[model samples]
Target: MSKDAPPHISGTPESSAKARARKLRMPPLRRRRLEFDDVNVVDKAMMKKAVGGTVVGNTMEWFDVGVYGYLAVTMGAVFLSDADKDAQLLFSLGVFAATFIARPLGGVVFGRLGDRIGRQKTLAITLIMMAASTFIIGLLPSYDTIGIWAPILLVLMKLLQGFSTGGEYAGATTFVSEYASDKRRGFLASILDLGSYMGFALGAAVVSVMQLLLSESDMVGWGWRIPFLIAGPLGAFAIYFRLKIEESPAFQATLDAQEASAKAGDETESLGTMGIFRAYWRPIVLAMVLVAAVNSVGYALTSYMPSYLTDSKGYDPVHGTLLTIPVLVVMALCIPLAGKLSDRIGRRPVLWIGAGSTIVLAVPAFMLIGQGPVATTLLGLLLLAVPVTFYVGNLAATLPSLFQTSSRYGAMGISYNVATAVFGGTAPLIMQGLIALTDNDMSPAYWLMFTSVAGAIAVIFMKESAQRPMPGSMPSVDTEAEAYELVAGQDENPNLDVDSLPFDTLGSQQGTQSDADPAPAGTADHR
Candidate 1:
């Protein structure tokens, strides 16, 4: 039979007539049609639940981190000794940076679990641990009450938060990405970061309110603890949402495939860090660079802004915190829009907009910020926020697209965490040190410029991934071309069940003619 021929009409003429009669008795297929449609083959309602579950954990983690950044000076006073104010602030931020130190470790541990077991379970564990740690920080005694142990406890709690978050941010992004259709992945995945920004914005709002309402002494004595304490309740709420959501069907399909292989006594393949690293080194390097650039700017904008305004621009800490609110709100709004735009135009274009715009505007924006008027500062900050939003908004969909399902969680977590630890987590401390050394108020701009350039270079190298189908199994080294070819090869083999399709289809270089092949029974789209 020709390849284009209709599927074999196997029934004999008499059986066909009987089947026609049965069809007339059955309900029409059109009656079951649903209005929602997207690339991922999931319904709209399920996708929303997935996004909600993923976003809550992200919000809680970032919220705690933002609270710490907003109250760094107060934390310094409470945790550090009766030393120089600058020294105390430095010590406090140093401890803040300590969290990044634990992230890479968390990435390895949690990423492994996510890849090996499942994304949902790993996220649940990390969220609980991170929230618990943040709550503990609020309960610790100050240096005046507990001596050096207070600072030591603070350091420990921060480290725990960092470690837990190591798994969280990346894991949440991966979870949402897997659930989203390729066409809508950018918009859906962007919600993960929107949750994060919202978390940070809410944290900043709380701190700003406290600073505005309370006396200086009251803020110093007790107001600093409120935000940290709030993490507990927020965490409980996040956990509830996470539990209500279902596992990634993509991951579950992988498991089903593995079980079938075992039952048939066929050898089932497993992915490891070394194997994944060897296959995906190019994307890994590019992802690290991309993440580093975006994160440096992100931390600079959110975590470092309050300190930068108060210390360098001579604004009140409360006013500095207040300024961040508008910036984060702009980011939160921009994230989903950027995601949808990327879906329309493509991920690479959005990334280019982010990197190129940041490179052009970073220096000028910082100059305006240093000018110190509310109007100029807001304008400068808004200029910077625009590019960063484009970058971050598209990141979840873009980054996870680089790897196959088997290796995606681990690859994303490790590379992203490494870059974040090196750049994003340290932006504020670096900015503080640079200003002190050079007395150049524009030092932060220089760092932003450097990272933005790196991001641009990475963007220039990234493969366009809009509407690209995810690999059903582990893809080969050339993920952009190989994944589609793999799917095509699977279509040519009639005996290979959908779950039995090899994760990596070697030696096939055919065009995507096989894309027309229908998915095997009980299988969803896999990439």
Candidate 2:
């Protein structure tokens, strides 16, 4: 036999057919997975990884927000040069609001992707978009050089930044919450806001330093660009870490459940966006109202406060920015602690206390700041900051827990963004209008007081979400209406039997099994 001879083949037709059949019997290869594919979704090993990536990314996003708000005066002078100083500031703040206008659309689009694809992926995309737009703003020509193109381009960039931001916070909160144990969900989620305030503080600090060191002309000319440009490297660093993390285990578990359902011939209707709206509308409205309070108070304290101090209260702008630094630091520290408190006690009590205090103190706090010899002004801000942190810290955990997991991202995104756009985004503009109209330095205080009423309504109606099983993991979606009644200490029927109610009434009739029927043991980790 020759050494290079082919394998001996039977010449018969039967044998040839048999060989072809054998070839066909070989099994197909399995799809390859990435290295971290098998890692636990809530892996203890990845806790620090998840926290760091989320905080850094959130910090960068909010840092841009901080820069825009803090540098509004300088940005206005540069980009809206044709207007008087007052008009320029108004125009600049108007550009800032432009970002909020696009936020709801961003929320819906990004929320869909987050729900459909994965949380980590949506977050990464948002971070990249936000960072790029922010960096580009740094390179824009002043109105003096580019004429009408300056404000026009500024508005467009603000739109992009707003769009990207629409998805960022909701996605980050969803990612962090899914990885966290329900017992600690409040504390963990609060860190997202902690990073946010830190970024705002950092932006203010940077601008304040520049204001102190640079000439007024220099700050208006080019110094403002440095803060915007810093976003580039910061975003890159966040992206690198974000890419290394595993997908959220809760999301992956949902996928596993869906696939298993498909194989078992259980054809459940997937609720599209409209379906989500129909089923989750009540909770969505409540969440939106709650966010309105948060943003209004937050922006008033952080963004509009600087301008109010300088323009209305007669404090130097530089000194005002510096004075607000301690208030921010106090908020940062209190945020995590408040989160922990929510975890131990409950979310509603903490929220109610915060909202209630704001109603009482808004006018007094504003008056103190207006009449200040610097020390009293700082004290007044500190009083307001404490209440603000209570709401901000618990928001990440409470908002997402408002609805079922399947539609959580969408509901939170749309509701939160809409509230933010209308209230938080407009805070500075509204304050300006109020001050101009009333000729009162404390006009902003009255606005804050009015907004606090919404916060009170939200807390009174919102159900306690602490340590509850997440929505989809259970066999049924939670009814927010029912929860509200239960937590508000209202009994719909003391005499009604629990078993008398229809099984499907708990969750909407969209693709969910009866609550009475137990799900497969392996499908979810209820704890």
Stretches of candidate 1 above 4 Å error? 1-40, 473-527
lDDT of 2 at 380: 89
Candidate 1's residue-wise lDDT over 1-527, tens digit each? 34454433544565567778888999765411111111124545767798988888888889999999999888898887577789888998898899999998899889889988899999999999999999999999989898999999999999999999999987888888777765577998999899899999999999999999998788879888898999889999999998887777556655555566578787456656666666667788999999989998888899998888887788888998999899899889889999999989989899989988888899989988988789999999898898889999999998887766766788788899999999988889998999999999888888888988889988888877776555442222123343344346644633224443332322112211011112222232323
* Each candidate's clash count: 4, 0
Clashing pairs in 1: 40-181, 470-527, 471-527, 473-503
Q: 371, model 2: CA deviation in Å?
A: 1.2
Q: For candidate 1, what is the lDDT?
A: 0.79
Models 1 onward score TM values of 0.83, 0.82
lDDT by residue (tens digit), candidate 2, 1-527: 44444444445666668778888998886533211121122456666688888898899899899988888878889998878988988898898888899999899999988987888888999999999999999999999998999999999999999999999988888878777765678998999999999999998998898999999899988998998999889889988888877776666666555566678887455556666666667777888888888888899888888877776777776887888888998899889999999988899988987788788888878877877699899988987896799889899998887765666677678888988999989989998998889998777877887787888897787768786545543221124333334334323433222332223322222322212112222231121
Worst 10 residues of 2 by lDDT: 32-41
Please list the C-alpha lDDT of all candidates, in the order they appear.
0.79, 0.77
- Rate residue 330 of model 1 by lDDT: 81
What value of lDDT does candidate 2 attain over all alpha carbons? Answer: 0.77
Least accurate 10 contiguous residues by lDDT in model 1: 31-40
